[model samples]
Target chain A: MSAEVFEPYQVFVRRDALDAMEHVGTVMAASPEMAVLVARQNFLRRDAAVGLWVVADADMHSANTDPQFFAEELDKSYRRVDGYSDNARRWKRFKQQALQLQDIVRDLESKEG
Target chain B: MAQDDKAARGPSVAEGAALVDLLLQMADDDLVLGHRHSEWLGVAPDIEEDVAFSSIAQDEVGHAALYYELASQLGAGDADRLAFDRPVGERRSAAFVELENGDWARTAMRHFLYDAFEEVRLDACTRSGWQPLQRAATKVRREEFYHRLHSRTQLHHLAKAGGEAFARLEHALADLWPYVASLFDLGPHAAELRATGVLPADAAALRSAWEAVVVPELSELGFGVPACGGTDATSAAHRGAHHPALAELLTTMRAVLDVDAAAASW
Candidate 1:
């Protein structure tokens, strides 16, 4: 039979229920059923995996391979939690002021007593 | 008797010998077939299948090692010696496993037949009165789930493909069918093993169960099911006699081990 008889299927594995499925590898099989079997045999031999997914290579669509597809023209740090570093600093200052106010209240209470 | 009673008392002299025989048969089958499957490492039709077969082969060999360890506890010698040093005539593996890994069709068909039988055999073993054997059988059966899936998927694919693929599978079935019965041959200790509850059933009963499962599936796929008889004479040849193919296979399998008499490890 010609090599074309087999189609490539991408394999994905999830280690646990809470984990996202990650790409493992590709396996060549004649049909989707065979693909899943082959994917399990090839990829799940050693590791513990709670989930597996096999997608036909033909069925997958991807963005252009050009670096421009992933390039960020402007800083997008604000989109990430690390960009809110000032919030962490402000929270620490707020905690310190609250502690000082508590101390002041305690001192007034002691003087009154 | 309960499995707990058998475990407490251990085996009698007769039962111990019978257990050794059973373990040898199980180990030999896996060792020979594992070697055969490992031969497909780089030569399989596709890279994915190559990896799959390799993993299956490793599991089979690992199973053989487990059986051999159990046999050693029963006075069957060390695992390595039992695996590599035994003469061909002494091996208990059925002939089906010793047959060449012909074309992909034959390989797939043989795998389906052998794995199906093995699945049944191991399932039965899970209930063995011998606790160690039962535990080992249970552990190995987990890995066998994938093997059964692989062989079944490939066999169905070949059967349904039609044209050359189907024809090739048919031809392979005709060639392999006669040897299928020999896989169930449990050797001279069969009765003793069964009576002692070391084996749940005799070869005939296991073979019938195997056929019950295998025949209808093949028929549904439009393939002719080979008629079952008593033990296959051809496979019987390998039960106590040496087939040339087995000798050749053993030579290759032992080549590295034979190279050094004093080597500490493989």
Candidate 2:
């Protein structure tokens, strides 16, 4: 009898084409291929998946313990359109101004006529 | 019920009987083998493998249900009754599937060999003249792709590991080789099924295709290839005669039903 030590892998699966791959769980296997096979059974049995992935635990670069690594170190909100949370209200204000501008333009045209 | 089933398939009673026999062979093989596979559920060598065996076992039982559903449509009786109530003499599974799981190596070896053969059978089935059989075969073959992947991956890894793992797998190959040919037996209706296009015209070619897939892989793995060909009696026996282990397996499988047949709901 041979006792073998297995490598652990993080399992990820994509539920469908439109879905992003989510980390489902982990499996212990001797190889990447075997890990994917084990992951299929462990993670994808009940639901359908368009794709599966297994990254060796050893290969993963974890910043999991360093909360500061993921922390916002600088104000970079300009890069995100959604960062302007009041943009909806701003757009509403703009729409009202545009309507008033349209009214003024019509009055100017009436005078010009 | 029989009339609707017959109308759906459009086979005469004589033809229906032959078809039922064929369906039983496929169902019994999967059911028995799946039961054996389930034995490894919580006790496999590792955690991942336990889940793997559980999935494989579920797939096998599901495939068996698929075939049994076809058989029932052809008037073979309730699927549960056909699976659990049949006497050993009436079962059509080969002695190969009926054997007990000896070890992880043996189980993997058997899984590899059996899935290879099933690939050929399901391929032929995808072209079956019976539309339901063809459709069912297509679906089963899709799920089975993963089974083949898992089995081949395990066999290749174990064979490459060398030392005791390699030796155990090699021993398993030798021990299981003798019963391999019986898997190709298509029962008494082989000729009739062939004539009606239920089975492919070159029925014997199925075994050839299986060997074409299996032999080179085993050879590359440095395992000795056992001599080819089973005796005529060996091929003929699997249809009606079964290994004694099947009875024991069925006893365990049907324990609840045997105790209280009327109360059994599921």
User: Which one is best on TM-score?
Assistant: 1
What level of docking quality does candidate 1 show? Answer: medium
Which CAPRI tier for candidate 2? medium
RMSD of 1: 3.8
lDDT of 2 by residue, B1-266 (tens): 34454247478777788889888889999999999999998899888889888889999999999899889978789998998888888898988898889999999999999999999999998888777788899999999999999999999999998999899998998878878767887888898888888877454788889989999999999998887765334643455667778889999999999899999866
Which residue runs does candidate 2 get wrong by more than 4 Å? A1-4, A64-113, B1-9, B201-203, B230-237
**Given the true complex, what DockQ would model 2 score?**
0.52
Cand. 2 Cα-lDDT: 0.87
lDDT (Cα) of model 1:
0.87
Q: Which parts of model 1 are misplaced by more than 4 Å? A: A1-3, A64-71, A75-83, A86-113, B1-5, B234-238, B264-266
Residue range A1-113, candidate 2, lDDT tens digits: 23355888999899999999899898888889998999988887888889999999889987677787688888887888876889889999999999999999999999999
